[model samples]
Target: MRKQLTVITALVISFASVHAQDATIEKIREQGLTQSKVMEYAFRLTDANDSRLTNSPGYFRAANWAKNELTKLGLVNAALEPWGDFGKGWDLKKSYIAMTTPYYRPLIGFPKTWTKGTGGLKNAEIIVIKAADSAALEAYKGKLKGKIIMLHRTDTLKPTYKPDAERWSDEDLSKMAAAKMDTSRRRGGPSRNVVGSMPITTRIRKLAEAEGAIAQLS
Candidate 1:
């Protein structure tokens, strides 16, 4: 009889505790739904700043703006704290690329980051090369001087009918929660040269530079 009474009392307390938590969560949900500045805050962070790479001028500007905004909201100790030094900062000023020969067309591409700028607008013939391996590179060894080389072919893109964004369903969440780590499969082994040294991607870039290729389309 005592054990039964103890179990009943414990279940009653548990039910009360659950009800209290649910009430608190509902209150929070109501408050969030009615009064939320999430969109405004998001816009201020993202739209206000063009780009915010760590230690860059844009990053510092965004940080300062955030600090000022937080201070306005009566937040204490809102200041930019110095983290350890990141590498040298760079900013993109003006970048443009285009195809002139065989009917003029504007090329849609961004300049490679942290690279030296082209002196001015350069007009060069685009040469497509297939140099997948060391032996393949030899064919274009004497070639590619002062010419823009294309390393890869253009891929055909298909339009998707599905919506770009959607909220996760309960079933989706359950599946994600129950998902197990996949550890069975192993990646393919590295390609080894005759000297047993792994041929790195840098070697190809170096070879292209040695051949006097102006710029490579990655």
Candidate 2:
């Protein structure tokens, strides 16, 4: 009789716990449906706090707002914690580029992060640098001054064949769900050669700066 009573008590307690969980979940659902601030939060995070680069002014604004918002929402220990020392934050105030030689047409371009700006409006000539090797760059060393440089070749636009949006097929879904881990790659093979070797892009930028070039366009 004692064993049976203990079993019954355990089952009653389990059912009561499940019922409480369901009631709490239903309350949450009702609150979300009635007082949803999803759109408001999204607007504040994205539209209001635009240009959220790390450690930038916009980033701090968003972070402070988020911390306070969480606190308002009854979350405990809502605060900003520093990760470590980081470089100076950069933000773009204004950007403008245009073609003037052949015809009057505004060019679509944005300043790269950590790139030095041209200070003000510049009407410098654009030069395409097609150096095959670092040795070939010597020829244009003195000539790049006051000129905008393009290090790489211009890209050719390709037409897209796939639709913008589509539902996944049965085969695609099956492949995604049944995917297994790829164990072919070894843990830590010999790392690629990076020491004392500068990338071609970095080399180009360094050369351009050393030669007093106005700016480099990708």
Best by TM-score: 2
What are the clashing pairs of model 2? Answer: none
Q: All candidates: CA RMSD in angstroms?
A: 5.4, 3.4
lDDT of 1 by residue, 54-101 (tens): 767778878898999999989999988878877898778887887776
Among these predictions, the greatest lDDT belongs to 2
lDDT of each: 0.79, 0.86
lDDT of 1: 0.79
Total residue pair clashes for candidate 1: 0
* Model 2 Cα shift for residue 113 (angstroms): 1.5
Report the C-alpha displacement of residue 203, candidate 1, in angstroms.
Answer: 2.3
lDDT of 2 by residue, 14-71 (tens): 9999999999999999989998898998888878988788988889988999999999
Worst 10 contiguous positions by lDDT, candidate 1: 192-201
